[model samples]
Target chain A: MADTMISEQVLAPIVENRAVAPDHVELIISSAVLSQAEPGQFAHILTPGMLRRPVSFSRIDQENGQVGLMFQIVGDGTRWLAERRHGEVLDILGPLGHGFAAPDPTKPWCLVGGGVGVPPLYAAAARYLHRSRPDVIIGARTADWVLMAQDFKDLGLDVTVATDDGTAGHAGTVMGPLETWLQDHPDGQVFACGPTPMLAAVSAACEGRATAYVALEQRMGCGIGACLACVVKAHGKEHAEYRRVCTEGPVFAAKELIW
Target chain B: MVIDVSVSLPRGLTLKNPVIAASGTFGFGPEYSRYVDIGALGGVSVKGVSPEPWLGNPTPRVWETPLGLLNSIGLQNPGMDVFLQEDLPFLRDQNAVVIVNIIGHTVDEYAQVAARMNHEPGVAALEVNISCPNIKEGGMSFGQDPDQAYAVMKAVRQVTDLPVMVKLSPNVTYPGLIAQAVEAAGADMISAINTLVGLAIDIKHRRPALGGVTGGLSGPAIKPVALRVVYEVAQSVNIPIIGMGGIATATDVLEFLLAGAQAVMVGTVTFQYPKRMNEIIEALPQVLHEYGFASVRDAVGQALPGRAPIRGGGQ
Candidate 1:
C-alpha cells in the first residue's frame, strides 16, 4: 500500500494546556514541522483514542518546522488526549484542513473568529504582520472564553475582542464589533473560522459586504476524503450535491458555501 | 511488516490481495487510493449505481453502535454518465480489479447498466447487487424470489459477454434458492450475504439510528451471519463464491474461504479504518504462508472440508 502520509513520531511538549476560556484549550505543540505550515492551515493530530483529531493551526514556526494545534475537548477522544503528560509524542497527521488564505500584498485584510475558531487566525495574522497587520476581531461566549488574548496582542495586529457576557471587550458575538469595524474598513478582505453556527452567523454578517473565506466544520469520518462520509450540500447547486469536508475543504468561501 | 495476502474469484481475475474494498463502502475506489493504493487490493467494487441517478435515503443514513455500524446509504451514486465521464478515467489508473457493481429497479434497468458497463474497457466484471430495497420491484425482491433472480440474471447474461457476479442479500429466507436461480441463469460468480436486514434504536435520539427507519447492519457484528450464509450458499451452488460481510483480518478472510467462498470481499472495515484494506492486503500473503499454501487457488475451498464440488458450483 502506498503510504500517502510520510509519518514520523514526534515528541511535542505541551507548551501550554489549560482552560484558556473554560472548555477550550489551546496547545502549542513543540515541533519543527509547525514552522513550515502556513497560518490558515491545520494539523490532523492523532489523539489517544479519538483516532485523528483535526485542530486549527493556530501558529507555526516556519523556519524550525514546528506548529501549534488548539481544540476543545468535545468527546471521549479529546478527553483521552487531555490526560497525557506534558512531554509526550502524540502521533499526529498534520497540516490538514485548508487554512486561511494570505492577504494580497496590496489589499487590506480583516480577520474574524469565534471561540475555538480564534486559533486559526493567529497564523494568518502572523504572516501579514511583517508588512502590515490586518484588522482582527475575535468573539467568545463570555469574557473568560477569550483565549490567546495576550498572544494576539503580541502579534501586533489591530485586534478587537467581543464577548457575550460583556466581561471583556465589546459585548456580543464577533459580528457586532466586526461589522462596525468592517463598515469603516471597507477595503479589507475577510477570513474567518468557527463552529458551523458561528461561521453561519459571520457569513450572514459579511453578506454583500466583504469577500470572506470560512473554515467549515463537519463530523469527519476519515479526515482524508475516501469515505465520502462528511459531505455537505454545496451552495447554489440544483442537485443538492455534496462536498467532502475533509478534502475539498474544511475551508470554503462563505459565499460559495451552501450551508 | 504485514505479509501480502489477496484472493481472486474462480475466474482468475487478478486481485492485489483477497481483501476487496466493498461497494458502497469505498466510493468509486479512486478516492481511497490517495491514502492507500486501491490497485493493490483484491479489487474495489464500486458503489452500487443504477441506470438513472439515485438520490438515495435521507441523512442520519449512518450510525455507529458499540462495535458495528448501520447504514441506509441506499447506494447513492452519480448516474452512469458521471461514472463513465468522471470516475472511469481515475479508476483505470488504479491497479486493483475494478468491479463495476450495478443496481436497478426493474429488470430492464439492470440490463441497461450492465450493457453500458460491458462496453467499458477497464472494468473487470459487473456485480449485480440485488439486495438494495430502494428500487421499485426487482431490487430486494429479485434477490428473494427465485424466479425474479433468474429473470434478472438472464436479462444481464443476454446483454453482456463480460463476467457477471450476482451479490445476494442476507435478508433472504432462502439464500440457497436465490443462489441456485442465479447459477442456473449463468452467473459467473456469487457474492454472498449483503447486509442482513437490521435496525437500531437510538435511545438518546429517541428514534431509530437511521432515517431509513430500517437499515442494513454490517461490521464485526455481522461476520458470523455472513460466514454461515456463505457456507450454505457454497454447498448449494457450483458457481464461484465471493464472500464478504464484515471481513477485517486475513484470518477472517480464510473463514469465508473455508466456508466455500472462492474469494472474500471486505466491507465496513474501511469505514472504521480507511487503510484497513491495506493491512489485510499487506499481511494476506503471510497469512497464506502461515497456512502453507503456494497460491490462493489451493486455499479457496480448503476451509470447507468435504463441501464437495457440485454442478454449477463455481465460475
Candidate 2:
C-alpha cells in the first residue's frame, strides 16, 4: 500500500552544533520524530555527493523534542558534514539502524563504550539513569579520545574511566576495569556499544558470568533492508542465517552474535 | 489546497502519490519505515520473491561507482512461503497497497506464484519480474524471447485476474516486441526497464567486481536508454507504461513522464537516500506545473519528438 502521506520538510536543519572532543562533534536537530527513536537506533544522514552515512543518536532533548547526533570525521561524508554550518539544511535519513537496548529498571548493569561507539551509550545511559544508574566503563586509546565523561557523570552513576595511554583514571584499557568490575559485580547485566575489538574484549572478559548485549555497525545501503549489503555472522547457524542491522538490530545479545 | 496529484494507476489501485518504490531496492517495506514512512509513497514493490528462499550471492554485493553503484544481490529473498508467513503480515499492517514482485523459472511457476499471490490479503497487484536471470531456472526472463515472455504472461493472466504489470529487462534485444507480447497476453501495464546487464572487474582481485560475474547497472547511466524504451513502447502500445532507471531527481521523473510513461518507479537511489521517492513525488507536481501542465498525466509521453510515431487510441 503505497501513498502513506507525510508533511514535507524532512531533512530539516540542525539548530545547534558543537564539538564534544577534538575529533568528535554533536549536531542537535529539530527531529522530534527521530528523538523519540529508541536507544538502539541510529541515523543515515546524507553527505555531500557521497552515500549517506549512518551515525548514532548520542542523546535526546525530550523536552524540546530534539536529537543529538554525535560523530567523528571518519570519512568523506563525515568530514563534509562537519564543515556544514549550524543552520544549514542536512538531508538526513534516520533514525536508520537499530539502537541499544535497556535492561529491567530494577536490574543493575554495566555500560561500556569504545571510540566513535560512545555516543549511543549516552542515549542508553540516559534511559538507564531514569531507572537505575548503571555502572559505566569507557575504554579509549588515550584520555583525549574518551567522549562525554561529564554527561555520564551528570547522570549521577558510578563511572570508571580507562585509557590505554594511562593519561586519565586507570592505567589500562577499559577492558581491564570491566574485568575487575564483572568479578566484583557479578549480578549486573551488561549493555555495551563500542569498537568490535573492545566489544569482543568485554564480551570475553565477562563470558558465562553475566548476560551481555553488544552493538554492531555494518556498511549499509537503503538504511532499510533492500540492499542486503549489510550482514554479520551468527553462532550455531548457517553462514546463510544472517540478520540485518537495519531491520533486526545494530544491537544483539552476546550469544546471538558470532563476532 | 493541494489537488492530490496522484493517479489511480489504471490498475484498480490508487496512488497517494505517483512515486512507487521499485522492486529489489526497498526490501520488504517494514524495514525502511523507521526512518521514513514508506506507506506514504504511491506504492511499494517488495523485494524479488521466488518459489524458494535464496541465500543470494557472496559479499561485495555492491560497489559505489560515482553517483551510483553496481549491485549483484541476485534477488535475495525468503521464499514466497516465508514472505507470506514472516513478511506479509507486517506489510498488511502498514495500510499501504503492497505489490508483490514475482520471479519464476517457468511459465507454470510464474502462474503458480501469481495465483498464490493473488490470494494474499494485502496484495494489490502482481508485478512479473522476468529480468532476474542472474539466478538459475527462475524468473519469467525466458520471456525475453517474445513468445516465451508471452507464454508466462498469458499463464499468469489465466490464474489471476488481479492487475499484472510486466517489468521488462533492458538486456532483451527488442524490448518493444516483448512489451507488445505482454500486452497481447493481457498485461494491464508495463514497467521498463530493469537494470542493464553489466560488469566491473576489480583489477586487484583479478575477478569481477560483483560476487556474481555480472550485475545490473542502474542509476543515471541507463536512464536515457530507459526513457527511449518507454517512449518507443508508449507510442507502440495502448497499455500504460511505468518508466524507471536511475531516477533520483524531479527532472528525471519528468523525463520519464514526457517519454509517455503514465507513472514512474524510483529504484537504486533508495539505497543512497531511502526517502528520495518522497522528494521526487513532492518535487513532481512542481516539475509538472513548471511546464504549464494542469495535471501530471498530461505530461505523460507528451514530450515525444515529432517523428509521427505510432498511434494507439484503440481504446
| Best candidate, DockQ | 2
C-alpha TM-scores of all predictions = 0.84, 0.77
lDDT tens readout by residue for model 1, B87-144: 8778788755888899888899999999988868888888998887544456787898
Tens digits of per-residue lDDT for model 2 on B90-159?
A: 8788887788999876677788789889867899888999877566565535656888888888999999
Model 2 misses residue B110 by how many Å? 2.9
lDDT at position B269, candidate 2: 76
Q: What is the lDDT of residue A106 in candidate 1?
A: 75
Candidate 1 residue lDDT tens string, A176-251: 8877877886665788887678888877877877777887765555455555555666764565666666666777
lDDT for model 2 comes to 0.76
Give model 1's DockQ, 2 decimals.
0.22
